[model samples]
Target: MAGEQTGVGIADPALEAAAAPLLDKLVADGVAGKLAAQDPTLWGSDAEAEASIRLSWTTLHKSSRPLIGEIEALRTQLRSEGIDRVVLAGMGGSSLAPEVIAATEGVALTVLDTTDPGQVADALAGDLQRTVVVVSSKSGTTVETDSHRRIFAAAFREAGIDPARRLVVVTDPGSPLAELGEAEGYRKVFLADPHVGGRYSALTAFGLVPAGLAGADVARLLDQAALVADAIAADSADNPALRLAAALGAAHADGAEKVVLADTGSGIAGLGDWAEQLIAESTGKQGTGLLPVVVENKDAPGFADAGSDATPVAIGPATGAAKIAVAGPLGAQFLLWETAVAVAGRLLGINPFDQPDVEAAKKAARSLLDNPDALRGTAEPSAVIGAVEVYASAGTTGEGTLADVLREFLATAPEGGYLAVQAYLDRLDDASASLLRSELAPRAGVQTTFGWGPRFLHSTGQYHKGGHPNGIFLQLTGAADDDLDVPDRPYSLGTLQLAQALGDGQVLAEHGRPVLRLHLTDRAAGLAELMRAVQELAR
Candidate 1:
């Protein structure tokens, strides 16, 4: 059998033996009620955030059973109000869950998680008269979310509609956003459990309200999620979540630095963004983390062929491989990975609950806006290769040629390190990202990750700069065919996008990371050439 056809699968027979000892220990710990005890020292003796760490465990239980009435009421209310669409504007944890749920369930919802003007404009492009604008933020002060709220609120008013009547706010109790929602007379305000953290709040009001509003079966989803808690509490080897945790922890210890994930079924792919943030932010501190790289099923071999150092953990059915399959188990997946990340943190001896370095880039980007002089090197092409041109930072060694810079970057990657493909192009095709991932990792003999620009600056960007220093950064940028301007800012949306890229690159360099920037006159042709270059280098 490839894996458990019902829940999650870690089917390798050898891994069963390797994982038994750890699984036994963890099961014993849970059976003894240690895991649920909310001890801060679970990760380390000096761990300081016990209160926050303990809250995440209760989220599954509290959210699934207790919040059913509130969830149903809101769904009924939305239907009666004739709301046909909902636009959720949030970032990271607040936005990823709804986006995944909307995709899996085929719901009428749009998630705006970027500060890119193009994305914001597209999300609000629909008819606002029938759309409920959900300005969602756990803290109520995320710069991107706030910007989206202001822009859309004004647009609604300009259309002669009452902004308050068409708006809803979901936030923690008494948060600045909740207060503002009340003051602004939003149509409704849904307060989340104060103790639940954003990432772990998938089963909470943050996700349920939006999922319900979008027409998903909230009750069934909760029922499925609750089973995860029960299985975890059972503390047995047959327990799916605990077994997965054991495999992940044991694999990382055996030198599989990269935890490559690929979803086989249609529903499983939707879990990528949420899984990335969950694993990256949770275990990425202390310079050791099980880097969770989400790959499409077809592209699994790219990382699988990453020599001896890589560990490819399949999340879906593949053609020929004994691998884990967490596909088709939507609610269980959310809890399963959440459990795995916490367990991995314990095994790695790092605090799983805190994200200590996520604020640095935000601060850096804000500083760039306040001081234009600090925006790093100009966005000019240093060398032209067919349709592409390469740019290097001021002190970069391979100054004149793009190939030289790429070769230097690839060679300098530490043993077992990963390559990050950060594309800042407006119209990059998913096929292109997949192709790059499939072709790069094996040749480089290291794990590879890909994310579109500006969006990634909010997610894995933290790990690249602050988690560990073993990353090679390849930035791909191109000219937009069309550009949109911010409502009142001095720069166009395109300009802001470029500034964000440069600002993040600057931060990476200051941290002594390997960084290279490529500019393309024609993105399609440039991407093809890049793939060829990588293939040749690998040979």
Candidate 2:
């Protein structure tokens, strides 16, 4: 309710009405086909499946049905056991839904979505006595989740707490995680129905975070979700989710090829990243799909409003200049985007929820860890360069060229360590190439990574000015036309200008590192050029 807004532009009642028939068709098909045909073994009993669906639908509709007794029993058990913090450990859909619930419910919780050792170290460093680690995976073998679990378990052991005491696992009953949980003598384990895909598990523990936290009536949330289900089932064009899908589908069909997810708060900001994985993995196939772009809406419209047909799916309270008025609107926007993505996936004949490339990165990172010495040969030495040449024509063709260039650069970069940021990855390929070059460079031989620290410098002025500079620095900035006028006194373009002045080329110059400054009128184009130049220079 806090983040919803209405009437940025007048509502098209006619357009809304047109989508009803399709929504009806989809619901009927879903209930009669997917939901009805689901195997009992995968979802528990028939009654359990029905209950899960009802609960999911209810929450979507904002109703007040409480969760059934079994769920409540689990929550009570957790409370009685002195579990103050519940960690939902999973990746992608397995974790995103629960994350949304936790953020929305205002529960004190921490999520470990990354497999990075540093992240695991931080989690382990925290007080484990009161922590309940919920290791969630549908298949029981998400590489990242498993890796992090091992790290956390080792940490728990080091902290003197029995690993079982701090662990609760949610996974398919016969799956690896479930088997491991039982064998390891975990204190409690919740087995998700194998039939229910990770993305679709929200009705279960996936959507139970808010209910568990507020001690809110689970039944009520279930009721709300059930209402949504019923509405979806009815198949009327008035179904917001269905209509949204239709609108998004039409846009994609008509060639609006990018989706920009913008979020203001820390909790919801990560959702953008999750959405990126979802959309890209699910729909980007067969040469037709919206490139899912994710970015934090920190009063910056750079990524959100970039393309001509860019649609902003705003999440949670409008803390910035978007000035959205209601949570209902934000909810509507989400449903719209979800529908759009679903439709796009349908158009591409692909599943909108699964991500295959996600594992490749994990595998590569693991392999790099396995053979750290292999990185030495791949590492590139720092060097100055000249202007990068562009070979492609303008518009879409140019975008494709940039993407190819980025892929080529990333393919050759070393496995680990920080690189400089020339452009935000949410934008075009040139920016992505810059990021890949800066962040993915091999640390085997490099002494320092260079990049301008405008945002960090502004936010951490005291620390940067006084703290030790153990890393390399590269400063990048440009004079570009502003996308939006800042209305508040504190929000000025000059702030960025001053940040650049204080921390950009001159800042790196003072630190006595090899600093390079390239000024251009167009930020996006300039970023692209800088990326190409870096690749050529680094090569």
**Top model by lDDT, which number?**
1
TM-score of each: 0.89, 0.58
Best by TM-score: 1
lDDT for residue 446 in candidate 1, whole number 0-100: 70
Residue by residue across 281-364, what tens digits does model 2's lDDT show?
445543445554444353433332333433444445444333121123223333333444544455444544434323333344
Query: What TM-score, to 2 decimals, does candidate 2 have?
Result: 0.58
Candidate 1: regions farther than 4 A off: 1-6, 48-54, 64-68, 76-82, 303-306, 317-319, 376-381, 384-389, 393-405, 425-435, 480-492, 520-539
- Quantify all predictions' global Cα lDDT against the true fold: 0.70, 0.44
Number of backbone collisions per candidate, in order? 0, 39
Query: Could you tell me how far off, in angstroms, the CA of residue 486 lies in candidate 1 after the best superposition?
Result: 4.5
Worst 10 residues of 1 by lDDT: 1-10
lDDT of 1 by residue, 320-435 (tens): 34245554356767777777677777877887777777777677767776666655446556667787777665456555344556666677778878888887754323237447
